[model samples]
Target chain A: MIAIDFLGAIGRLFLGFLQAIGTLSVFTANAVSHCVRPPFYFRSIGQQMLVIGYFSLPVVGLTAVFTGMVLALQIYEGSSRFNAESAVATIVVIGITRELGPVLAGLMVAGRVGAAMAAEIGTMRVTEQIDALTTLATNPFKYLVAPRLIAGTLMLPVLVLVADIIGVFGGYIIGTSKLGFNPATYLRNTADFLEAIDVITGLVKAAAFGFIVALMGCYHGYSSKGGAQGVGAATTNAVVSASILILAADYLITELFFSK
Target chain B: MAVDTRIPKVSLRDVHVAFGPKKVLQGFDLDVMPGESVVVIGGSGTGKSVMLKCLLGLVTPDRGSVKIDGQEVVGISDREREPILQKFGMLFQYAALFDSLSVWENVAFGLTQAKGMTREEAKPIALKKLAQVGLGADVAELSPAELSGGMKKRVGLARAIAIEPEIILFDEPTTGLDPIMGDVINDLIVACVKDLGATAISITHDMASARKIADRVAMLYQGKAIWQGPAATIDKSGNAYVDQFIHGRAEGPIQVEVRA
Candidate 1:
């Protein structure tokens, strides 16, 4: 009897997971369709872009710069042991543009923006504001989810682009100031080693990560039950899921693009 | 032959809904006439909100039919439901005002977004509605966060009525307010619905609110309307559940689940 109960629990868990995936998939399809449909809420979309993109600049910038500096220091220390200290500049540029910059920005924004969406929408859900939207003839997807999704997807790439520049510059600052390298050659090496595909791939990953962050946040919040505790849980779930999905998506995109 | 012209504005038949094994509604049925104010009363966890949500298409029933204005709405696509949805306005419990937007913006949201009215055009109407709800122009620029509970409820009411909907829904409209404030909101709801000649359905455990705003009272229990009658006769309702609820008695035919 105990064995049967254990098996049943396992079966229930599997079914629950599948159900979550199915619901999220449908939500994504609905949100995407709303994003493309006419009668767009331009002002709402613009406001969300400002919140998700413009406000995120400072955090994303700080993260990218610090990461770039640290990457430069680490590569210099490792390569110096093999008499290949010159590789530091090349490594720093590649690391920032191709990986660190986008991933760090994605994760930072996920923590900041994803949690906000979840909390805001979750509060709305518990407060019955979302249902109010429905009765007001406003589609929650169009008024709420679509704006955030578009803002997140469109804004993250721009953020990552700026982060890429700042990150490389961070590496340059550290190389010249701390690590005693020829400034002109370090800059040239940085430019020479960087490829367009590397930047493009990172940006594509950033966009996907942005979408994931918004999607997870909106899904959790919209479906949130009860009051304060439920909103809190949704906020935490949004950040965790967005971070995990970002890392996973980053790896997949990398494998698709760079792996032979 | 004379026509039977009095069709219900909203109708639900044998509706069933469940979350997992917890069935919230089983064969629930209700009919609401146009220009009628029907208040549904029940204890907590009695599926009152679920029934309201089902009527609004926010939650779909596992089985049964929902008809709005004599048109079948159950299982209809979102695009098809837009016109139907446009006929509604709702007042949420706790106000549910959007914290992100200023007071006027929240009130004007549906008008500008769903009706495609420019901000300039919608501003006067929003201001007018706010005044009607006993709020002044000074409060229009304030965020919802800055408002008192009563003020927030007023703003929420203004927003609800601004769209001039043919139907209005009120969800626990008196839940978080003092008795005086609750009475004020109840009065405003009655006035607004009467002014619009809209069909209204409200769900609340507040007897005072129900007595004040309801033209008729429906008692929901075990996923169905166990008793329904005119509000004037509530003091002598005679139904056990209704009596227990109105008197706040602990012992009745309605079971309150408690774990030992």
Candidate 2:
């Protein structure tokens, strides 16, 4: 009987997982299709871009700069034992552009923007506002979810680009100031070591991460139930799910881009 | 053709909806006439809101027929649902006004976004609708976040009526307001519906609001409307459930589940 109960629990858990995946996939398809469809809400999309991209600058910028500085110091410290301190610029630039910049930005935006979307949409759901939108001849997918998806997918790359630049410069600051490396040589090594592919790959990851952030936020919020407690749960779930997906997607994307 | 005038504006037949193991609606049926206001009153978990959601396609029934103006809406695609939805508007329990937009902008959203009217063309109309809800131009530019509950409901009503729709749904339109404020909202709903000559359906547990807004009153119990009559005769519904609910009694056929 205990074994039977254990098997039942496993089966229930498996089915629940499949059901969640199905629901999320359908939501993702609807949001993406509506985002690109003809009846576009241009003003709302532009507004979302400003909200997701422009407003995120200060946080993303600060994160990139600091990470770059830290990476430089760590690399210089570690490499000096092998008399390879000069490798600091190359490793910092590569690390920032290849992994750190996009992943950190995605996670940050997930916490900030993702949680906000979930809370806002969850509140709408519990409050009957979403139903009100439907009755008013407005599709919530088009009016609510599509704009965020578009903004998140498109703006993250731009944010990643800015982050990449700032991050590399941060490493440059540390390399020249703290490590006593020549500014010109550090700059040359950083630029020469970084390839367009590295930047492009980071931007691509950013786009995917952005999509995950918006999708998780909108999905959780849209499906939220109960009331204030439900909205609060949805907000927490959005941030956690988005952050996990960003990290997991980062690894998969990295494997895809660089695997033998 | 001769009896066509008697056809229901909205009709639900044998509708069944379940969320997991819990049955919210079980073979529920109701018909609402054009230019008539109908109210569904029930206990907290008795599916009053579910019935309205089923009619609106927000909650799709597992097995049922939902018809809007003699056309079946049960399995219709979004393209088909759009025109039908355009005929409706709703005032939610909490007003669900968009927090990012100013009061007038929220009212103008359906007009400009869905109806394709330019914002310039829609602003005057939005202002008129706002005025109809007793909201002056002073509150037009204020964000929904800045408004009190009563003011928010008024703005929600303004938004619902902005399109001059043929059907208007009020989902507990007076739930959160003070008694005096609730009465004011009730009066506004009556005036607005009468002016539009729209078919109206309101779901509420508030007997006073239901009595004030309804032309016909339906008492739903265990997912079905057990008794329905003209508003004047609700006091004489002759059903114990109706009596227990209307008089707000604790001891009744409807058992209140108390949990620690």
Candidate 3:
């Protein structure tokens, strides 16, 4: 009897996971289809772009700056033991432009923008505002989901590009001022070693991360049930899921782009 | 020979919906005629809202057909359903106004977004609808969060009528209002429906609201409509369940489910 019960529990868990994936796949397809369809709400798309991209700049910038500064200091300490301190500039630029800048910005935006999207959309769901949209002959996918998805995918690349520049600047500041390194030498080192593909890869990763963040937020919130407590759960789930997916996608995309 | 060309504005036949082990509706049926006002009365958690959602295609029934204007709406694609949905206008329990938009924008959303009218063209009509609901032009720019409960309901009602729909649904329209305000809303609903000659379907536990707005009253119990009659004859409905519900008595044929 115990063996039967254990197998039953495991089976249920597997089924639940599969069901969630299926639902998310369907939701993604619907959102993408609506994104290209006409009767588009250009004004709403513009508004969401401003919210997801423009309003998110400061936090992403601050995170990138601090990360670059700390990385430069750490790389300097480790490299000094082997008479390789001068190599810190090259490593910091490569690391910031290729990985840390985009990943950190993606996670930060996931926490900030993802949670807000979930809360706002979840509240709308519980309150029946979504249903009201349907009754008024408006498709919630076109009116709500599609715009956010488009804006998030298109604008994260832009935000990540800005973050990459700011992070490199941060490394420059620490390298010249704190390390007693000549500013021209450090910049020359960084420019010589950094390839365009590194920056391009980060931007592509940011686009994927942005799409994941927005999609998770919307899917969880749209399916939220119960009431206030349900909306709260949806908000939490959106952040957790988006953060996890960003990390997972980062790894996969890095393997695709840079594997030996 | 006179042809009876008027089809039921909304109809559901043997509808059933369940969540896990709990069945919300079982073999439920209702037919609402054109230009008629019907009020569905039931206790909390008795699936009144679920029935409304089923009719609106927000919640799909596990079994049965939902029809609008004698055409089957169940199992149809959203693209095919859009034209049929355009006939409906719903006033939600909490007003459910979009907090992201200004009051005027909320009222004009269907016209400007769904019907492809320009904002400039829809603005005057939105203002006219607001005036019909006794709201001043000053209220148009205010956020929904800034409005009182009564004011929110009025804004919601104004938005519902802005498109001049042939069918209007009210989901607990007077639920959270004071008695006087509830009466005022009831009067407004009656006047608006009469002026437009629209079919109205409302669900409420408020007998006062039912008395004021209903041409016919249907009382639901055990997922089936147990008693139905003309509004004036509710006092003499002759069913013990209806008697218990109308009199607000705890002891009756209907048992309240109290979960531990």
> Among these predicted structures, which one has the highest DockQ?
3
Query: Which ranges in model 2 have alpha carbons more than 4 Å from their true place?
Result: B1-5, B251-260
Supply the global lDDT for candidate 2: 0.91
Q: What docking class should model 3 receive? A: high
lDDT of each: 0.91, 0.91, 0.91
Model 3 bad stretches (over 4 Å): B1-5, B258-260
- The sequence of per-residue lDDT tens digits that candidate 1 reaches over residues A43-73 is 8889989988999999999998888899899
Candidate 3 C-alpha lDDT tens digits along A160-209: 99998889888889999999989999999999999999999999999998
Q: Model 1: how far is A45 from its true place, Å? A: 2.3
What value of lDDT does candidate 1 attain over all alpha carbons? 0.91
User: Tens digits of per-residue lDDT for model 1 on B21-47?
Assistant: 999999988889999999999889989
* lDDT accuracy of residue B123 in candidate 2: 92
The C-alpha stretches of model 1 lying farther than 4 A from their native spots are: B1-5, B258-260
**Candidate number with greatest TM-score:** 3
TM-score of 2: 0.94
| Model 3 Cα lDDT, one tens digit per residue, B128-190 | 999999999999999999999999999999998888889999999999999999999999999
lDDT of 2 by residue, A91-184 (tens): 9989999899999999999999999999999988887778777877789999899999999999999999999999999999988998999999
DockQ of each: 0.75, 0.72, 0.82
Interface RMSD of each: 1.2, 1.4, 1.0
